[model samples]
Target: MELYFLGTNAGVPTLQRNVTSIALRLLEERRSIWMFDCGEGTQHQVLRSPIRLGKLEKIFITHLHGDHLFGLPGLLSSRGYQGGTSPLTVYGPPGLKAYLDISLAVSQSRIPYKIEIVEHTGGTVFEDEGFKVEAALLEHRIDSYGYRVTEKDSPGSLNTELLKSYGLKPGPIYGKLKKGEDVITDEGVRICAADVVREPKRGRIVTILGDTRPCSGALELSLHADLIVHEATFAHDLAEMAHQYHHSTARQAAELAQEADAGQLLLTHFSSRYSSFEELIPLLEEAELIFPETLLAEEFSAYPIYRRQNGQLGK
Candidate 1:
C-alpha cells in the first residue's frame, strides 16, 4: 500500500501546500483506492498523480470543515464526467449526506453511478474480508474523527515441492489448502495446510487523523500503527496557541506517536505561517527528537506501508 499526500496545509491553501487530502492506494491489494479528506482542488491533485479517479472506491471524511469537504461536490461530479462507473461510498459525520445531497441537487449534477453515504459514529465504520476500518471521535473544535485501518492476516502460499512429494497434483484441492483448509484428495490422500504451507504473513496497520489536540482518542487510534498521518499545525514553541485552537503542535504530535508506539509518524496539516522547507525543518527536528522516525509530510509525496519483518509492528 502507498499513501499519497495530495494536500498538507491547514485551514486554507497556500502557495506551497493545499489543504488536507490523502489517497491510500491499494492497487496491488484490490486495484482500488480509498480517499481521506477531499480538500479543495483534490481532483486536480489526483490528476497530477498516478491515481486513477475511476479506481476510487470510497471516501472518508474527518469533519465538516470547509477545507476538508469543499471539494467533494466537484470531485463527485467530475468522477461521473470522467467515466467512473462503479458505485462510490462516502463515510463521514452526520451532516455529510445532507451536505452532498443539497449541493448536488442545487447544482443539478447528474452522476450515472450510484453513491452511498454512511454517517459514521465511531467504532468499526467499515470491515471487509481483507481489511477493517475503525473510527474514533477526536478532540477538535467540532466532532472530528481518527481512522485506523488494519489489513487482515493472510494465509501463506502452498509449498509446491512438498505437495508434489506427497504425490498431490495441483488442482482445486490446492485452492482449499491455500485457504488454510485440510483437504483429502479423491485418491484418499490427506493434506494439512499447516504442514505444507509457509507461515502466515502478518498484516499492516495505518492510522490517519484529522485536526485535533493531543487526546486519548488519538493515542488509542494510533496504537501500533505502521504509519500515522497526523496534523501538526504548529511548531513546538506555539504549544500555547495549539491548545487554544484545539490543534496539536509538532512536539505534541510526536509525543503522542511515541507514547502510542506507532511505527512511524508522518506529520502534515502544516500551518500557513511556516511557508517554506527551511521554516518547517525546525518543527520536523523537534518531532524527530521525540520520535526518530518522524517525517514531515509534503504535497504529492508518497509513503509506502510495508509489513514488519520481526517483533511487534510498531516502535
Candidate 2:
C-alpha cells in the first residue's frame, strides 16, 4: 500500500501546498483507493497525481470542517463525470449526510452511481474480508475523529515442493490445500494444510488523524501503526497557540508518534505561515528531535508502506 499526499497545508491553500487531503492507494490490495479527507481543490490535486477519481472506493471525513470536506461534493460529481461507475461509500461524523445532501441538492448535481454515507460515532466504521477501519473521537474544536486502517493477515504461499513429497501433483487438490482444507489423496492418504503451509503473513496498519490537539485518542488510534499521518499546524514555539486553537504543534505530534511506537510519522496540515521550504525546516527539526523517523509531508509526495522480513510493517 502507498500514501499519496494530495494536499498538506492547514485551513487554506498556498502557492506551495493546498488544504488537507490524502489518498491511500490500495491498487495492489483492493484495486481501488481510499481517501482520508477531501479538502478544497482536492480534485485538482488528484489530476496532478497518478490517482484516478474512478478508483476512489471510499472517503472518510474526519470532521465537518470546510477545509476537510468542501471538495467532497465536487469530487463526487467529477467521479461520475469521469469513469467512476462503481458504488462509493463515505464514513464520517454526524451531520455529514445532511451536509452532503444539502450541498448536492442545492447544486442539482447528478451522480451515476450510488453513494452510501455512514455516520459513525466511534468503533469499527468499516470491515471487509481484507481490511477493517476503526474510528476514535479526537480532541478538536468540533467533534473530530481519527481512523485506523488494519489489513487482515493473509495465508502464506503454498509449499508445493513439500506437497509433492506426499505425491500431490499440480491439480485442483493443491488449490484446496492452499485454502487450508484437509484433502484425502487419490491413495486415501490425508494431508493437513498446516503441515505444509507456512505461517500467515502479518498485515500492515495505517493511522490517519484529523485536526486535533495532542490527546489520548490519537495515541489509541496510532498504537503500533506502520505509518501515521498527524497534523502539525504549528511549530514548537507555538504550543500555547496550538493548544488554544485545538491544533497540535510539530513537537506534540512527534511526541505522540514516539509514544504510540509507530514505525514512521508523517507530519502534515502545516500552517501557511511557514509557506516557504526554509521556514518549514524548523518544524521538521523540532519533530526529528523527538522522533527521528518523522517526515514533514510535502504536497504530491507518495510514501510507500513496506513489510519487514519477519512480516511486520515499516516505512
Candidate 3:
C-alpha cells in the first residue's frame, strides 16, 4: 500500500500547505484507494494527483472537525459528476451521518451511487477478507479516533525449486499445492504441498490518528505498526499551548511513536504558523531527536510501506 498526502496543514490552510487529508491507495492489491481524512480543498488536491475519485472505495473520518470534513460534501458530489458508480462506505463518529445528510439535502445534490454511513463508538469499525480496521477513542477537543488498518496474512509462495525437484510442472496442480493439498501428477507422483510451500507471510499494519493529544489510544493504534501517521499541531516550545488546545507537539508525537515501537512515523497536521520550510525545520529537528524514523509529511508526497527482512514495516 502507498500513502499519498493530499493536505497536511493543521487547523487551517497556508500558502504552502492545505489541511488534513491522506489517501491510502491499495491499487496493486485491491484496485482502490481509502481516504483517511478529507479536509477543505481535498478534491482540488486530488485533481493535482493521479488519484481518481471513482476508485475511492471507503472514507474514514476521524472526527467532525471542519478542517477534516469540510470538503467531504463537495468530494462526494463531485464523485457523482465524475465516473464513480460503485457503492461507497463512510466510517466516523455519531454526527457524521447527520452532517452529510443535511449538507447534501440542503444542496439538493444528486448522487449516482449508494453511500453507507457507519457511526462507530470505538471498536472494530470494519473487517473483510483482505483487511480489518479497529477504532479507538482519542483525547481531543471532540470525539476523535485513531484507526489501525491491518491486512490479513497471506499464504507463502510456492517453492518452484522444490516443485521442479519433484518433477512437477506448473499447472492446476500448482493451484492445488497453494491450497495446501496433496496432488498426484499425470506421472502418478504424489507431492505434498507442505514440503514445497513456505510459511505464511505476515500482513502489514498501519495506524492513522486524527487530531489528538498524546494518549493511550494513539499508542494502542500504533503498536508495532509498519507506518503511523500522527498529528503534530505545535512546536516543542509551545507544548503548553498544545496541551491547552488538546493538540500534540512534534516532540510529543515522536515520543508516542518511540513508545509504541512503530517501524516508521509520518507527522502531519502542521500548525499554519510554520508555513515556510525553514520555519518547520525546528519542529521536525526536535522530533528526530526522539524518533529518528519520524518523517515530516509533505503535500503530494507518496510513501510506500514495505515489509523489511525482520518482518517489521518500513517506508
TM for every model, in the order presented, reads 0.94, 0.95, 0.96
Candidate 2 wrong stretches, greater than 4 Å: 187-190, 308-315
- Minimum summed lDDT over a 10-residue window in model 3 is located at 306-315
Order by TM-score, highest first:
3, 2, 1
Return the top candidate by lDDT: 2
- Steric clash pairs (candidate 1): none
Per-residue alpha-carbon lDDT of candidate 2 for residues 13-42, written as tens digits (9 for 90 to 100):
999899999999999999999999999999
Task: Please write out the lDDT profile of model 3 over residues 105-161, one tens digit for every residue.
Answer: 999999999999999989999999999999999999999999999999999999998
> Candidate 1 — which residues are off by over 4 angstroms?
183-190, 312-315
Residue 196 lDDT in model 1? 87
Q: Tens digits of per-residue lDDT for model 1 on 63-90?
A: 9999999999999999988889999999
lDDT of each: 0.91, 0.92, 0.91
lDDT of 1 at 177: 87
TM-score winner, 1 or 3: 3
State the displacement of the C-alpha of residue 28, model 2, in Å, after optimal TM-score superposition: 0.9
The top-ranked prediction according to TM-score is: 3
